[model samples]
Target chain A: MTSDSRLSWRDVRDRIHEHILTGRYGPGDRLPRDADIAEELGCARSTVQRAMQDLSDSGLVERRRKGGTRVRAEPVTRATLDIPITRREVEQSGARYGYQLIRRRMAPAPRGVVAAFGLGASRPMLRVEALHLSDGRPYIFEDRWICPETSPEVNDLDFTEESANEWLVLNKPYTRLDLRFYAVSANPRLSDLLETEPGAALLVIERTTWVDDAPITTVKAITTPGYQLLTGS
Target chain B: MTSDSRLSWRDVRDRIHEHILTGRYGPGDRLPRDADIAEELGCARSTVQRAMQDLSDSGLVERRRKGGTRVRAEPVTRATLDIPITRREVEQSGARYGYQLIRRRMAPAPRGVVAAFGLGASRPMLRVEALHLSDGRPYIFEDRWICPETSPEVNDLDFTEESANEWLVLNKPYTRLDLRFYAVSANPRLSDLLETEPGAALLVIERTTWVDDAPITTVKAITTPGYQLLTGS
Candidate 1:
């Protein structure tokens, strides 16, 4: 597209970002009003507003109610991560997905589970331990706890046919989600379960969900060695 | 916040979300047009539109240009992660921040770096290794490769006083970013540098950036044990 061509919001955002990258607008420098930018670029003011909103969302700029927009002094690299159901993840990778339920029982919530849910006290919950396989090889071992008070239907249905990861994601809609990533050295038990050697480094993805301030579930998905989690492009 | 009070866009969103959570609107169900929902809720069409946009952004709904909106058939959990400059991250955590430059040199880009940048062939790049400290303890060890062709200013400035991580973030504005997280077993060299034991599991955050298809830099930030990366709340 030529410079004089009709500009989309992305085009407008790129032009504004070009100005900033060229040092025309230094750190913490105030940007022109949306109207002025629209006039200069021969685009609608709404287009400029959209571009500004995107830049603001990406942590490149800060927008104030009446103070206009300014470049962020400390720019942050913002990324979006989408964690899909393990079955979907494996299938999308062109692998035959398999799941096995290792154990299921009703037990008191552990201290870690209680802290994750921010519960007042420990309570009875359904605990599920399962393994996700890709092409008959171990992929991820998940330890999940379901709050029966919030999801009573889980108690009626056995997870032998389908994994809880797929069931809860399809049935329950969470208002809030908490995600964390860390690393752990696989112990002998975990190594045996994941079919990896002991002392191997593994990535752990911890996810906790809540629906309208009520606990839904908390899960720790420990992946086998060399597994990588990538952000959505 | 009574039910009959003037409703904001957030109120409209929560009401619609409650319907989905309560099974009133099942998966893959088409939502009413924005205008109809606005009239039923006694709000403006623009307000309903905003609420729908929020839902769509969070992976709860799918909005088609000509087909209108519907609940996502398979919901994915979406989260935003903001990785600020390491110095800012340390200071924001209420800890004193320190930086040390370990090595800086110009070398031929490695195979991994070339693949990260999607380059046609290997090229000479500026390689820098640095350590970020919190309260005099190693927080993160970064091994970075900067494309001198894209950033020529790096040739003049020595990264002794300020870290390349902080400097590049402030100076460079990338149009594209690639992020990956994985675990690594600390080797003897890495263990000595990070002051950790051998075979310790470490979290590695690899980031690659480009400015409009021109490669900028790629860095692998290896964190010490017990470090966790959390999603933005």
Candidate 2:
């Protein structure tokens, strides 16, 4: 406590978190104002602000503009998931990554694809089907659609050497993203593609991105059986 | 652009986001300092700081303590998942909620349960099996384990009317949480409990919570077939 003025935001955050952990402030309890905490702890108000922001981001507390901050009455199990590029994800897991373009063409957006982008009318989208391999085994089979208006350069890329997943993540900056997770029983075609047994339960990650209301891309990455997506905070 | 003096943090955030969306600032580009952006926009430095915080939380930009901020070259698909209590979740989705406690007893921790808690040895813990329903149809089947030392009050509560999920969330304040998502093919027992066919693909959410390293509870909530979990930002 003697180094109160020198305490960093992390220190302040830990102190406040300890208070909650020790039952000093119970569930649904309103926390002290930023100014009061700053004055009492002998730290800058901005430091307290930073700590509170971290707590809010992690779903420990709820912050309102004028209503002040309070511990969440029914605390949620909050998790942040950061899905990376396919090749990078494979390589990071210590696998030798490979890519194979299964199909590529300019086709009218399908009903599902149109619905995913919230488009009123079907448009010609660059459809790319590819398989991401980790050490010669299929890791993910991606079926993707890219809008030509937003990503005209996608037409120029052959997609054989690099996946649309890798290329888009590197070149495009999206303003919005939607991600979904679900399970599906592998059909004959899917089982053959993923080299898994028929009726195997597989996890699917569906992602869509856009910029300024203009659709960029939507992809469904179907993984092999026994795939688990994990996050912790 | 001329209303710079009256701009709010949200306004500044949108302007900077516009630069990224319009390709004025490409991926991996370092953004201006908070002070520099404040001076350019004719706003207070705190305003820029607030805007940057928003961008960072959304995973659009990465902020370092002294290294400043930069546009992410590989933008991760960041999703925030708020898992709520089961009854509330069902009611919020406009469904008639129902609960039934299938079984409850103090039993020795199973191998998997001990491994989940990282305990040195197996001990007697409260094991609970319950089913959540929507309009008398099985929705989710939960297998749960609770540490009696951490949650002594759980013994007094009758879970027949209200689920253990809701009771713990309301009473216990966990300092740590671990969540896992995966898929499983329903076995005979699980199929009977969830009212699904054997070999049906189901989504499973495994959650574990701790208070200061003392394990509070761990539960595996297995949703009925065709359930999908989604998040967007």
Candidate 3:
């Protein structure tokens, strides 16, 4: 809708935004031409134009000079999806941080892990289970699987010294990383590790790092008590 | 260190990134002069300079010709945090969508809700609680708080028919929204509302919206599993 609060442009802008968000007008759906909308809504074309501009600026719609306007094909790009190391995140929030690697084992990748890391189902991978702490409190339960073929150096690692993220950055530096972010319901193990109640809400981040285009490691980190991530242009 | 595979640039860049990330050289912390770093790392000053440039390009550092360089204070500002609705997120992953409002309350704001909305602790507020489904499965729980002081009309709505976000965009208009993203441990109540085991990870979004300078709403939505938020330049 037009955000012309001073002159009722808001009414039109909101109308358009509502139509698009509610799926009355799906992505790629063309909007009524300004003149047509003005007639349909019984308002001035100028108001419709103003509202269209507002929606376009917020990435709700895409406008072209003579091509008309269409709802966006996708929502505008968003923020960090796969949660990253709690050490970095906590430090970002001005908190002190520490980490411990509980164990490192070589095991066959689980089905979910294999698919997520894009590895062969039967591949034996290096798995590391670790805990990240913030101000001495358990902050994250991180479980990771590394493709042995991608980083053979996993055999020489010592989890008690530093985090896998740190070790890989310095020892087996990756060339690229794929990250996924989302929310999940906590399980008993996660709740116990995070010191929260079971079935509580937690933010989960999964990442797969690649070296020379080869998938290297898949890391999953879950956080408790939640925190906000901020990003802007 | 530099990213030069043949040179030492890669190591230099990684070194600098490590320092910035690990708080060895924190926000607003200045890097030593080019000569100093080159000497310390046993690399050419040009290589160190290139490394710094790489960090700058990645939104991790700042550099000036002769003034040396300093770590950036506003790291999150470079984050691309976009607000999204359930349909869009689900469809992006080739999944289906469904939405339902399970609970709705119009009463005094709770402790966190009141403070976030700037409403008095005893002031009345409107609260909306709902679950979003994907392919017939619970995917998200939305807990939204609207300050009656900001929009007195919100208390008279039936959100079961439509989302409060949609209603606000249609009936109540606003500009300027402050969004923060973070990992959150789910509270026990949220665990049950979302049908997840307690303490499961959740994707939490907190938004404080405004028109001009008056706050309108403070919304916190928690989403279920397989919901990944991703963004890039």
Listed per candidate, the RMSD to the true structure in angstroms reads 3.6, 4.5, 9.3
Q: Estimate every model's Cα lDDT from 0 to 1.
A: 0.90, 0.86, 0.69
Per-candidate TM-scores read 0.88, 0.83, 0.59
Instruction: Write the residue-wise lDDT of candidate 2 on A101-196 in tens digits.
Output: 999999999999999999999989999999999999999999999999999898689998978887786556566788888889999999999999
Tell me how each candidate scores on DockQ against the true complex.
0.64, 0.51, 0.26
Candidate numbers sorted by lDDT from highest down = 1, 2, 3
Superior by TM-score: candidate 1 or candidate 3:
1
Q: Stretches of candidate 3 above 4 Å error?
A: A1-85, A88-96, A105-108, A120-125, A147-159, A167-177, A181-202, A224-233, B1-59, B62-83, B90-106, B118-124, B131-139, B147-160, B167-204, B224-233
Place model 3 in a CAPRI quality band.
acceptable
Could you tell which candidate, 2 or 3, scores higher by lDDT?
2
Model 3 chain A is weakest, by summed lDDT over 10 consecutive residues, at A76-85
The top-ranked prediction according to lDDT is: 1
Choose the strongest candidate by DockQ. 1
Q: Rank by TM-score, descending?
A: 1, 2, 3
- Compute the interface RMSD for candidate 3: 6.1
- What lDDT would candidate 2 get against the real structure? 0.86
**Which stretch of 10 consecutive residues in model 3 chain B shows the poorest summed lDDT?**
B74-83
Residue-level lDDT for A86 in candidate 3: 52
